[model samples]
Target: MRLLNNLTVRVLIAITLGILTGYLFPETAAKLKPIGDLFINLIKMVIAPIIFLTIVLGISNMGDLKKVGRVGGKALLYFEIVTTGALAIGLLLANLIRPGDGVQTAAVKGGDISKYTEQGAGMDWTEFFLHIVPSNAIKAFAEGDILQVLVFSILFGVGLTRMGELGKPLILTFERLSKVFFNILSVVMILAPLGAFGGMAFTIGKYGLSTLLPLAKLMGTVYATMFLFVFVILNLILRYYKISLWAVLKFIKEELLIVLGTSSSESALPQIMEKLETLGCSRSVVGLVVPAGYSFNLDGTTIYLVMATVFLAQVFGVDLTLGQELTIIGILMVTSKGAAGVTGSGFIVLASTLTAIKVIPVEGLALLLGVDRFMSEARSITNIIGNTVATIFIANNEGEFDRAKYNRVLNQEAKNELADYKY
Candidate 1:
């Protein structure tokens, strides 16, 4: 029972064991890739509904229906500040470390191009944004169109607010339903370590050590940047708002653990939503801000995209020239936002970016592909911090956050204050 409670420890062990298995027996690990895919499918199965339920409930519960606009402004503002800092850090790292200059990628030229080429067509910028609005909401879920699901959730929530007293029963029902879905997500999270292990094993088996290479440089830069963003940057942000970063983390410990293992921030959404609302953030603020954040506020993915593209270009002896670097940023700005909040989204956005730049060989993606699973942990962690901060900051500006409630609910003595609250 104690071991089950220590999700972080279990996840660490899983990652360690996975690396060992892949290192000792690459072929077996490679063959076991489907296990990783199955794990991803399992989590993805719950995400759309989780997003919808949380957003709808979160919005419906706002004390006043009109606060949504103030919430949106502050939330978007918060996202911009945090994400810009992320982008700057990524750029700074890329410039300083020159992650690409050292090595020669011998096998990069020979991977099967057929697998990537076919998947990349018709993936233009216009088509990407267009896909955000679903032709049919149900079909969107079936197809994993997260943005569309988000759009539907927001509209539904707004509809609820507009209906006033007539919608109370339905709103109450959705609020309960969101709680039920979150309970289900908690059960699913028990598999996180298994998912992480399988995914890491597949990564190692596919790429091997030769693929990721002298990890200290690139990995260190990314990990360091992520650490600074959360600890240094977000710590300041939280402090400015008279909140405790430690307390916020303590509150979301379970969700943080899930993101660490799954490497998919989206997987942690329901839990984050539940925890935030419990922390005194108005539901409407959380609803609009969080889903929109998933689409518009991808600080982690964007930073990684910038750093990785530069790293690849530098490694291949290609000069990005000042103009091209900006071009890369411009491309990333759009593509990373287009990324849905799901596992493997970073890779898809990276693929899109790679396709756009024509600077590095798409084959370079194959290089990172090997270590991508490990890297996902970093991206996921950054995303978690970015969103959590965004949610709170927005709530503060709109007067939607009950600072007094935050203090009370987050106080150690008030541990179960929200235990009786409706979902």
Candidate 2:
């Protein structure tokens, strides 16, 4: 009874039952999408405000402006290096595995991907950066634009810091407001299992398990690559910083399950940030790195974009040269940064990359439509882990982390697990 009451266990059960329900009664399962959608909307409703207050507090509390710039600079540089490495790995593995080779494109069903392609055609790399500075802060908050909100938060925090003692009252008020929002979030998280069930059910019901048969190899390759990236490459990065990857994963297990269930990393952002702070990362680091990571440091999406592009090239029998492959990397480095944590954004980035290259058929995107939902879980989980590790790394580097606190929390968690086991 105690185990059944656990949210992680409940979410896991919900995912399994959701799959079964979709398989047995897809029509009923299809109707559950709104359940997931409503849960996601509830999450989004609080995201902009939480980000604004948390960041403002983090910055205003930290008196050093130069450290803020340094942290942000280091984060962007790290994102570029790691994501580029991920792209290269994907390209290398795709060439070696040839997942799309000898595939039957004729038997495959293609969807109307023109919307993605049209969006791709209109994707301006310059405009993406320029759009980061919002013309109107009200519209930015109303729309839940993460980038714009982030820019404003940083500036507001800086302005408040300049006010010194005068800012204390406002900071206290924001602190109270932050607590209120987080309290509300705790209430919202109780419904995670239903969101998990509805999200999984809708995917399986609408797409059906049989849809994966035609593209099993591609799906397998993608999952395998992500697994390697997380455990191998990301693990190496964490080890260099003297942090335990397994420990971090264990700490954030609940958030990871939420991301897996919903197939949206955004669903778990606030919770993940809170957990990171609890693990001893500074508020300034978590607030800055996580939100920025959503836009800039998409390791999983970068891997998928590169691999999918190369896979399509093989499917169409368009042989890419060494120079062409390098060009693909360069192109993806810019375009992949535009992909958010949302589900369909990966396809948009891929479409934009293909449009830029022109060697691969943009229509190849339709080949992926069926299996994309299934792979989204992989992408989202990887992304959240990547950002979490990034925060820990940056915090440790800047001496903002509390190792004593981290150890204490981990020990307490271990004791709890032992008690739960004996129960």
Candidate 3:
């Protein structure tokens, strides 16, 4: 019964059942997409409010404007360096593996790439920056615009901090309200199994497993590259700060599973923030870093964008010069940031990058239409892990992390696992 009640176990079971259902009853499983969509919608309803409150509380509680600036600066710098490396690594691996080589482009079906191309072409860096500051805060929340809410939250929190004693009652009220929303989140998470089930079912049913056969090589390369990026590159980053990568992974296993099942990292955003606090990251760091990381620190997405670009170049027999490859990296560094809060952003960003480079045919995107869903799980999982690591690293660097609390939490987790094992 305890095993049955375990969320991780239940989610695992749900994924298996979902896959089986999708494979066996493709039409019915495809219809189950709404179940997953509804669950995501339920999570989304709480997301804006939670982000607003958390950022407000974190900044107000910190009481140091300079520290906030320092934290944000450090996070942005870290995001740039790490994501650049991810882009380089993806390019390197794509060249080495040649996942797109010897592909019969004639045999593969291409989809309508016009809308994505249009979105990509229309994406403007200046407008993206301006969009961060919501003209109307309420509108930002209503639309679930994360970056807009983030900007508003920071400004509100700063104002609250400056107000000092005048803000005490409001702080208390905010704290209480935050607790209430989290309680609501706890209730909502009970439906995660259903969401995971439906998401997996729909993906398998609609795409079908056979869609993977032709693109299996590309899929394999992507998964392999991500695995190395996590265990090797990310592990080294943690080791530099004397943190245990394995322990951190163990701590957030549930969030990782949720991301894996849903193929959406945002699904686990709020829960991961709460868990990071429990694992000893300060509220201020978690607040400032996690949301921003979602936008700027997309290591997984960066890798995919580069790899896919190179893969297409190979498929179309377009030999990119060394200078052009560098340009691809530079352009992606900017376009990839546009992914924040955008649905189907991976393709949109890719389309924009291709348009900018003018070497790879944008039509090649159609070839990936079938398998992008399958690869999304890898991207989402890596992204969440990357963000969690960023929060922990930044917290420790700023002396905001509580080592005692971290050790205590890990010890308790170990004890619980041991007890469950003995059961």
Candidate 4:
């Protein structure tokens, strides 16, 4: 009974119940989607404001312009290097395993991929960069455009910094407002179990467990690759920094479970930011790196893009030469970055990558449509872990991380909680 009071234990039980309900009574479970949607909406409601406040506050407090530039540069560099490795690993594993081999393409159910294809077609790198500079900051917030909000926040913080004494009061006010939103978040998070339950129910009820049969190999391969990336690749990176990846994962197990049930990384974004800050990353570094990582550093999505593309090629019996495979990697490096940390954006990015390569038939995506939702948990989980590791690495590199605080939090010696909760 005492264990039931713990949020993590409750969420875990909710997930189990959701899975069983989804399997036993799929129709009723499908209707439960609203509960999940409401929880996610509540979380989303606070995201834009929290991000804006954190970035503005982080930058204003730093007081060093060059450090910001250096951090941004290092972050971008790290994103490219890490995601590139992800792409390469995905391609390598897909080739070695040949998950698509011997599958009959004609049997696969084709989804309405036209919408994704159209969205992908409109993705222009130049326009993506230009879109970051929100002409109307208010509109950006209203639309929940994270990158745009980030731009606005950075500029606002820089401008506030320039004002010196004039900025102090405003900074203090922003800090207070930030606290308010976090308090709101604490209340919102109490509904996480319901959100997890609804999300899992909708996924299983809509898709059903039987969908896994046809594409089980593909699903298995993707999951194995992600597990390898997290445990092997990410572990080595953390070990270099003298941190245990398993310990970090255990520390944030609740967030991972929520992401698993919800199948959307965005559902846990605000909490992740808060947790990372508690883990000794400077707010500024957490602010800049984690959000930007969402946009640019999608290690799992990148892996999925490569594997899915190759899987489609093998399914259709289109032999990809060494050069053509390299081309796929090149195209994925660009298109994969366009994949937001949302649920279905990965399929769109995969569609666009195939269109760019023009080697594999886009219709081959039909083979994956049924199981995409099932694979999404893996993608979102990997993405969240990647961003967390990036934040810790960049923070440590910039000397902005507090090792003592991290140890205290991880060792259960200190509790990072909000005491003044207001309704």
Candidate 5:
């Protein structure tokens, strides 16, 4: 009973009940989507402000513009390297497992994939880069375009830093505002269980368990590959830093669970930022890397893009040559970054990649529409972990991490676990 009072426990219970409700009374479960939407909106309401304040404060406080550029450069390089590894691993596994083989093509349940295809077809790399610079900063925040806001914030921070002593007061004020928004996030988080319930209920009710039958192989392969990437690839990286991957996972288990429930990494963005700071990563590193990672360092989305593309090719009996597979990789490397941290962005990016490849039928996406929501949990969880690890790596390498604080937090957490066990 006492354990039931914990937020994690309560959220788990809510998810279980939600799935049951969706399975039993799908009509009613579908209605609960608004409850989840409200929770996400509440979280989104604070996101723009929090990001603005955090970025402004983080950059202005750093005192060295060169360090900022260096950090950004290192982050982008790391993101490319890591996500490329993810793409390769996904491609390799999909080829080996052949999850799409022997599947009847008639199993496709065509949905309106035209929107995604249109969005993909219109995707221009130049336009995407230009879109990062908002015409009006206010409109960027209003629209919640993270990349645009990031560009604006970086420029704003550089301008403020140029002001030298004159900027200190404004920086302090922004710091206070950042705290206020985080407090607002705390209040909003109280409704997380309800959000989880609604999100799970709606997904199950809308799609139903029957959708998993035909594509179970693909779904299972995706999850297994992600598991391999996390434990094998990501763990190797973490081990080099002398950090335990399992320990880090346990530390952020709550955030991971929240992502699982919502199927959106954005739902836990602010909280993850706060936790990373608490874990001793510098505020500036977290501010820049975390937001940027949402756009560029999408390890999970890259994996999915490559895997899904190959799976679709196999489903349609299109045999991609070695050169074609390499083309897929190159295309996805660029297109995958187009997928933001939103829930359905992956589908759009996938559509875009497929159209770019021009071999696989775009209609193959219909096969994934039903199980996409289910696969999102793996994607979201992997994304959060990847970004968090990236921040830690960058911070530690740049001497932005506080080793003493990290040890203290880890030790305290260990003590808390021991106490909980004893009781």
Candidate 6:
């Protein structure tokens, strides 16, 4: 009880236990993997509806389609710039570190790029754009079509906005459901430590250190470069701004621990929003930025994509000239947006990029596949922090931030309790 009350402390305990479990009882921990898989599935089960309802509620409250477009456009532009820079930096570091330099290993089997769309991965751009319409809302929900659900939710919300008073009951009902789901999220979070333990244990057990020995430098470079970017670039951005990353991150240290342990930032989504509110962001801003960014502004992961691509091509001794590398970045900028938010998304996107570049074999993705889970926590942790900071900074610039509320939030237990109490 005491540990749970101290969020950061509890999360640290979770991490320590997970690492201990993974290191000390590799076989036993590996068998316990279902706990993590089940936890992830439970979260995914709620995602489509949560995104639909939250987005609808958020948009309906906006009350103006024109405003929604403006906010969305600005938000997306921010995502693009930040994400591009991240990819470039990753490319740069991978080039500098040359982690796989002077190493020779037998090539692994490549991927079948055709598999992406067969398994609930989003369709191609044309088909995706066309299928925005839900043939049957019930079936769409049952199938868990996020884009379709997003489209339906947006249109429904716009209709509600246009309806004004008549839609109040429906909107209120959605609000209630949103709270219920969020409560479900909190209860689900209790399993975070178990998930972290099982997930970490299985990852390390399956791929021992020997798998990563040759590529450790590459991994180290990626992590080190991100550390510099966060401390340096992020400092410059936030020093002149309200709402320090350090403070907000400290507040949500528990969420970060879960993210670190499980390597799933999505698991931390609900708590992030709650903490954002407690950090005094307008509910609208938090509602708008976080969900969309989950799909869009994955800067840290973007870096890994470009880095891994170039690093692998280099290791393979295939030369991608400057023009080709730039072209690859441009292609990734667009495709990465289409990437899913689930586990192994980075690998999937890497597979797609490798196929497009026609340089490195899709098998190159297999190089980092084992360690991908390890890198995932770093990527996700930085991505969330960067996204949150960017959103707050943008809101501050737009005069959308509430400073007085922010100060009150840090000091006031009641408001923090309200944020904690999802239902």
Model 1, CA-based lDDT = 0.74
Q: Model 1 over residues 203-239: C-alpha lDDT tens digits?
A: 6777787755654477777778778778888898888
For all predicted structures, in order, the TM-scores are 0.86, 0.98, 0.99, 0.95, 0.97, 0.87
- Candidate 2 residue pairs in clash (backbone atoms < 3 Å): none
1-423 in candidate 5: lDDT tens per residue? 566656777789889988999999999998888988888888889887887787888898787999999999999999999999999999999999999998886775657778887877777877777777899999999988888888888898889999999888988888888888999998898888999999999999988999899999999999999999999998888888898888888788878878888888889888889999999999999889999998999889889889999999998899999999999999888888878933368888888788888899888888888889899999989999999999999998889998888889989989877766676
Model 6 lDDT, residue 300, Cα: 77
What is residue 384's positional error in candidate 1, in angstroms?
A: 1.8
Please give, for residues 113-149, the per-residue lDDT of candidate 3 as tens digits. 7888888877787888788889999999999998888
**Which stretch of 10 consecutive residues in model 2 shows the poorest summed lDDT?**
335-344
Score residue 153 of candidate 4 by CA lDDT.
Answer: 87
Candidate 5 backbone clash number: 0
The RMSD of every model to the true structure, in order and in angstroms, is 4.5, 1.1, 0.9, 3.6, 1.4, 4.3
Which pairs clash (backbone N, Cα, C closer than 3 Å) in model 5?
none
**Candidates 5 and 6: which is better by TM-score?**
5
Lowest-scoring 10 consecutive residues by lDDT in candidate 4? Answer: 414-423
Clashes of 6: 1
The candidate, 2 or 4, that scores higher on TM-score is: 2
Query: Distance from true position, residue 144, model 4, in Å?
Result: 0.6
Note the clash tally of each candidate.
Answer: 3, 0, 0, 0, 0, 1
**Which residue runs does candidate 2 get wrong by more than 4 Å?**
341-343
The better candidate by TM-score, 3 or 5, is 3
lDDT of 6 by residue, 384-417 (tens): 8877877787677666788888777666755565
Among these predictions, the greatest lDDT belongs to 3
